[model samples]
Target: MDIEKTFALLNETEPLKISTSREITVAVMGAGSRGNEYPEYGKLFPGTLRVVAVSDILKSRREAMAEKWSIPADRVFGDYREMLEAGRGGKLADILLIALPDDLHYEPAMEAMRQGYDILLEKPMAQSEKECRDLARRQRETGVMVAVGHVLRYSPYFRALKKAIDSGLVGELVNIQHQEPVMYAHMAHSFVRGNWHDGKATTPMIVAKSCHDLDILKWLAGRRCVRVSAEGGIALFRADKAPAGAPERCTDGCPHEKDCPYSAIDIYERKRWFLYVFDLKRDCPAEEILERLRTTDYGRCAYRMDNDQPDHIVVTLLFEGGVTASFSLDAFTPWGGRRTRVMGTEGYIEGDGKTFTLHRFRTGEAREWSYAPPEGGNYRDSGHAGGDLALIRDFLRAVDTRDFSLLSSSIEASVESHVMGFACERSRLSGTKEDV
Candidate 1:
């Protein structure tokens, strides 16, 4: 590809094509939570950043987001490549915010880099280890700015914890214990019977949801995970458990429709309806989604869906420098945040998803703080805990400063997380410890 021509093509599509200065224009590769980069980093953008384009495979999703965000219709593309091609045409955007599905991050990022666009990629960088390495290698070769979606690194709670650790508030870090329940309803709704039903589509559960924990563990230990031992199985929600009279499609006289907690109608159509019904209301009619919920495999009773991923997982990680960490994800918990207990030689830290408590042996006292993010800093507000905005801001800074190292989760860091994820999966399957 002619880099300069591609750049020109993208720039030509911009609303204000005549004048250019230090302002950074961005194109969101996918209209997922990572696409709404405004909420996370808008405070810092001021008049310097602009969201010029957005793309997604679903026309309704793209159009709905574009309309909501006031992006010109011409800037929306069903294909991200076409969007990038336009960017290449005339400098449409300086950075690419990649919030596509887990399996779709690599190609668009590589293409964006080839055309000289910086990248802000969502977590789990790519579908496989090889893809992660390729992206990392390319990033190294091109020296293009790339920031991974590791939002917690920028959060206040974690920042404080890191400071305390460095200051010996927690003394010498020892073993860490944490539990991240996938939540039965959440796993059944999203991972098992929901959109990401196949491991191929989303790797394993660890990578899909708990990569953040893995990243957090790494950050806290300040050491790499050397090995991982895990055990996980599909403890619930299997095809054999379908109700006797349940239809393959819930629309047809399912006996459990009214009372089953795992009912697809209740989960997707009635109780949890707000997500698809409210969020994508502009594109997907609530009734239509409800009707579809009653007719498709996605509508099958949660317990009866063809779910293959584990519903419960236990993982033990051995980090370099003898730091041991244990993590569990149960699929039956109620909707809540997360809980973590970090025990060090000097003190211990306990977090119950909503709040965290740290005890220092030096003082024999504990300090506690709520884990709630600021009111507007949440992504669900803008889309995904405001991670997109923060990600975008970081990418823009890297672009303007020509500093690829500015990545909060550099490609190398992201790859290491993926490697740990793979190790966890291997241990889950083989019932043995796997080296990271």
Candidate 2:
């Protein structure tokens, strides 16, 4: 329950000795942004981890990953099941890094564990509660470790916040208020006209976007969520909100191209990095980018697209021991980051993901802490404010030592958070409180 102590145990483990040079072999199940991001851990910890095989439906992506890692041609497969089959003979990989979609997580994860490999799964473990429980049961039955990607748990800002709370800087945590501002541009690209547009087709907004917040709430409270109530709906980004005379596709002669904030051409052209979402060729000419946008979902008008995710949502949680928390996710913000306020018996702490301020009742003064990446460090480049790199490092260590306790986001511990997310969705639908 003391998250700081849990992180300390993970960090204090002995480094690999010169004489005991063993590298964990990893097989990637999806070679998208997240898949590519995790393998970069090998670059940070030289010779400690190797990606041996990769599986993706996209030939270009899988082949590119195989080439990047120097994996044998035979080891690359279009199907994850084939990759798992190859690993069953103990010849391919020692671990499975699953960065597949929300609905695709359960199958690959279950198969990988059944094939005798530990797993590093992306969050929202599965689409439904039954799937989550099944994955947990599989891990327990097989005695294989499974680490979920709750990257915020490894972030420096949150870790410091947790430490301060545990050290009684805040006498006792009584309530929390947290907000996730999903920037407007990002919301359009990812939720409005992108792959995760529909809640019924894939997942609810809470489960797909804010599971990390749910996990953090549970972690900070250090108690199980007992009840949840939520209220939200798709307030914007629908057909009714489409501009008059606007075409279904942004590139299809929409009159508001120059003025529309959610114009696909403007958004995608300005931030070319977002092309990764289309899974298309990157760094292409402007004509090519425009052509692709004209024909794909990525180019669709944000309001006209078949998106069901809410533009705003708020959830209230009741934790064990009478603690309470409230969380909000809004897509209309100018910035993208989380802000949190923790109220305690003696004081309260406030954070904006990059810095924190602690106010004490006794001193009538505030203490501040800010995060600065180390000199020549790639924290920002590594993504998630350095949490991604830290997570992979801890996961690699846990795999190397075969120590489940070394991970803070193990499958068993993470499923509860996913449950909270599902419960929030249910509450939103039923218009009543739901038990977690």
Candidate that would win on lDDT: 2
Candidate 1 lDDT, 1-436, residue by residue in tens: 2323322232121111112247777777777654654423543434567666889887777886777657897898998778877866664677778888887888888877777777778877888888989999998888777888887665445554555555555668888887887666677778877657677777788888888888888887889999999888887677676668777766667887787776666766666543552244534555877666765566766766666778888899999989899988888888645677888887787876434676767667666654444433333233233333444555566677777665677878888988898889888888887988
Candidate 2 least-lDDT 10 residues: 11-20
Q: Candidate 2 has which clashing residue pairs, if any?
A: none
- Show where candidate 1 strays beyond 4 Å: 1-22, 37-48, 68-74, 87-91, 277-289, 371-388
Model 2: residues >4 Å from true position, as ranges?
Answer: 1-21, 271-273, 278-283, 372-381
Q: Report the Cα lDDT for candidate 2.
A: 0.84
What count of clashes does model 2 give? 0
Please, what is the whole-model Cα lDDT of each candidate in the order they appear? 0.70, 0.84
